[model samples]
Target: MVTHINLKRCIGCQFCVQVCPRGCFEYDFEINKVKLVNPILCLKCRACELNCEGDAIRIEKPIFQNFFAQLI
Candidate 1:
């Protein structure tokens, strides 16, 4: 799941908004920034984090999930 978006680091490139599969992010035209609007719909795919050119998106996965993923 997405934990945060550092507004200071965000470049408003809309990469996160464009790459999110679940539509968890939206471009806020008023602010010219990306907003995390549907966080509950996030699939923990890391698409937003990977696509963010500004390195603004942060995803928080559980410790156990990380442990299990390393084993796979």
Candidate 2:
């Protein structure tokens, strides 16, 4: 599973935090943004990325990408 945060596009709307069933996201009041507090806890359901209007989240890269990524 892949989970990333793009602060440039993220509006800190908390959509990811609210939609994540695994409690993988958290809000950082200091930065006025959301953070991936527990990526391993993600179920790779893509709910966070799909619900993100800002398109800042990406989960589960393609199978080929995952295979090669492990080699590196």
Q: What are the TM-scores, per candidate, against the unseen true structure? A: 0.78, 0.79
- Give the poorly placed runs of model 2, Cα more than 4 Å off: 62-72
- What C-alpha lDDT values do all the predictions have? 0.81, 0.83
Q: lDDT tens digits, residues 1-72, model 1?
A: 335899989899998878888898888898888888987777778988888899998887555544443234
lDDT at position 51, candidate 2: 93
TM-score of 2: 0.79
Q: Report the poorest 10 consecutive residues by lDDT, candidate 2.
A: 63-72
What lDDT does model 1 reach?
Answer: 0.81
Best by lDDT: 2
In Å, residue 6's CA in model 2 sits off its true spot by 1.0
